[model samples]
Target: MFHTDCPAREVVDHVTSRWGVWVLISLRSNDLRFYELRESIRGISEKMLAQTLRALVQDGLVWRQVEPTTPPQVTYGLTEFGREVGESLAELFDRITQRLSPRDAG
Candidate 1:
């Protein structure tokens, strides 16, 4: 797993990137349009969000669907594999946040 040449390294990097995990977790529950996703994840800039979504889509962790409409709406959601990954990441996130809560910080 630690080998530099390992293919999983790229996937791991994408999955655990600064915004990757958050993106995955955000789309886990429901499909969301670009603006909705940006709103859901506070403090993320438009450029950063676009880059993150593009990476996730390329990795097959997120599915992007474009609707034929006046403005051509685009939505993002997690794939089956992505859902599994998101579930695991969500659990990890919960544990970390719980441990770092004010009550636990003596």
Candidate 2:
């Protein structure tokens, strides 16, 4: 790990990336398999979903567990560090929604 005074930019890339934010939020609800995550996150293509997961996995923010079943299953969930990011993002979402709740009428 390269030493840095602050890694805010790297954190932003992991948290605010198109799929990164969503994937983190989705995992906050519960652990989900690869396809399950894809389905839970609507409007996202499989390729993008796979790509995002790979990035998160590499960052050590998302944990991937494989279950040996007949066909095998893989689940993704947030690591402890990821949970903090998820909570922060969730609060931001709530604030945005509260602020935009009304005033769309003529």
Candidate 3:
């Protein structure tokens, strides 16, 4: 937890939350439809994913686009700022995974 109360701390909490990290990492590569995001990140409930996306959008870290088609297609992707942060998060995620892998327990 961050010791100081600052805007940056709130943003950090949002990005580093368990669900937030997965959402950001999933969108880092390409824009994804709602169902696609659900498929990409397993075990996340529809409610939670929606909430996560909404928070990211509010933070300007994610972009939500709605196509005015017959059914109104909705897609989510990383914004310019999001891409920067996503890339950094991706790297940190990778490092965390590698470091915590069973092979490293020796």
Each candidate's root-mean-square deviation in Å? Answer: 2.3, 3.8, 3.0
lDDT of 2 by residue, 1-106 (tens): 3456557666667678888888998899899998989988888999998888887888778899989897889999999988988899888877777777477321
Model 2 bad stretches (over 4 Å): 1-8, 102-106
Error of model 2, residue 104, in angstroms: 7.0
Error of 2 at 10 (Å): 3.5
By summed lDDT, the worst window of 10 consecutive residues in model 2 runs over: 1-10
Give model 1's TM-score versus the native structure: 0.89
- Each model's lDDT comes to 0.92, 0.84, 0.91
Q: Which candidate, 1 or 2, would have the higher lDDT against the true structure?
A: 1
- What TM-score goes with each of the models? 0.89, 0.82, 0.85
Cα lDDT of model 3 by residue, 8-106, tens digit: 787787898879999999998899999999999999999999999998999999999999999988899999999999999899978887788688743
Which residue pairs in candidate 1 have backbone atoms (N, alpha carbon, C) closer than 3 angstroms, thus clashing? none
lDDT of 2: 0.84
Candidate 3: pairs in clash: none
Clashing residue pairs found in predicted model 2: none
Candidate with best lDDT = 1
